[model samples]
Target: MKKSVKILLIVLAIIAVIAFPIIGTYNNLVSLEQKVDAAQSNIDTQLQRRSDLIPNLVSTVKGYATQEKDIFTDIANARSKLAGASNVSDQATADGELSNALSRLLVVVEKYPDLKSNENFKDLSIQLEGTENRIAIARQDYNTAVTNYNTKRRRFPSNIVSSLLGFEEKPLYKASAGAQEVPKVDFTK
Candidate 1:
């Protein structure tokens, strides 16, 4: 082999050795980021399913508790806010509000034995409960994905590749303030 040709081959081999690992790191980051995105979409899907069930549940309750206008209005407003939420933080806050409203509505339902016994109300309640469970699972999956992606992007070698490739850390879905407090339902009014 000629001397220049051997030098050229050595240089090319060195470039490949360095480039391959960087390319692999970039692809892994892309895959992790995609998992986070998919998890987020799953949460959205479950939330939408719960949202769709709300109106039917509300209507069934309305038939039995026509005098409880304020509770219904609160639920409607909360549902609207949840539907309008555009991001993780906004969705968390809105979800908390809706949960509070739903709790109050459930409290009011206790006053109407007939509404509780109605088939439509019972079915809707069961479906809503299932949907809430799904949402919780989805949130867990999303946070796990975010944690994996963030940890990978922050690690030593991957950190260099991530920063160079503009892979920003993803935010985990957190509960809103006051989420742990039980909603107050005033029955005296």
Candidate 2:
């Protein structure tokens, strides 16, 4: 090959070598982003399940604890706030509110033996607890996926591509203060 032609060939090979990993990283980032989205969807579904369970649980308790109107109203308000949440931060804050409401509601149930022993309330509480556990798992998975995506996007060469393509870092799905660990159930319901 002639000198200029050989130089062009070498340059093309170098460019191709550099391009490969960038493409791979970008693809991996996209996959991670999708995983995060799926994880978020899982969490949302679980939270919705818990939301649905709450009204039934509250009504069941209401039959036994008629005077505890404030706690029920608080739960209703928290549920409304959670349903209105639009983003991770809002969701986290609203989840805290809901958890607080639930804690109070459960405390009231603890005092009412009939409410705690009710079959329907027991079943709903168990389902709600299971759903909450699923939500916690999903949030952890989402955070892990976000970490991987953010690492790729913020790294040297991938960062260049990410910046050019507007791949912003995703926020981690953080649990609320009370939600750091699953709630402990004492009296079944």
Candidate 3:
């Protein structure tokens, strides 16, 4: 080959070598990001399922414990907050609050044995519990995706591509500060 041809061939080969891996990395990042988004949507779906069940549970309780207005109000407020949450952090915090409120509502149920034994209440409680489990699994999946993406984006040559392409870090689903403390349930009222 002539000198000019040899130089041009070398330049093209170098560009191909660098471009292929970057393209692969970019595609991987996009796939991982989509996984994270889908996991997040799953969490929201479960949360909404739980929220939909709450009104029925509350109404069933209302029939027996008409005087327990405060607990019902707390549940309503928590549900509203959860519904209004736009991001992962806000959702986590609101979720924790809703969990606490549900705990308090359950405690109120303990006061009325009839409510606990009622078929509708029992069914709603079971459904709520299952939804909670689904939410937990979804959060776990989201965090796993985030970890994988973040690790890849922060590593060797991929990091350079990630930064150049503006791939930002995804937030994990974390419990709020109050989540550590058990919700207080007082029987004497």
Candidate number of the best lDDT = 1
Lowest lDDT block of 10, candidate 1 = 95-104
Score residue 113 of candidate 3 by CA lDDT: 87
Candidate 1: list runs displaced more than 4 Å. Answer: none
**C-alpha lDDT of candidate 1 relative to the true structure:** 0.93
Clashing residue pair totals per candidate (backbone < 3 A): 0, 0, 0
Higher lDDT: candidate 1 or 3? 1
The candidate 3 region of ten consecutive residues with least summed lDDT is: 180-189
Question: Cα miss at 164, model 1 (Å)?
Answer: 1.0
Look at candidate 1 and give me any clashing residue pairs: none
Q: Write the per-residue lDDT of candidate 3 for residues 1-189, one digit (tens) a residue.
A: 699999999999999999999999999999988988898899999899999999999999999988878788889999999999989999999999999989888888888888888999999999988988998998899899999989999999989999999999999999998898988876656
Angstrom error of the Cα, residue 80, model 1: value is 1.6
Which residue pairs show collisions in model 2?
A: none
**Candidate 1 residue-wise lDDT, 1-189, digit = tens:** 699999999999999999999999999999999999999999999989988999999999999988888989998898898889989989988988888888889999999999999999999999999998999999999999999999999998999999999999898998889999999988877
Model 2 scores a C-alpha lDDT of 0.83
- For each candidate, give its TM-score against the true structure: 0.96, 0.86, 0.95
Q: Which ranges of candidate 3 are over 4 A from the true structure?
A: none
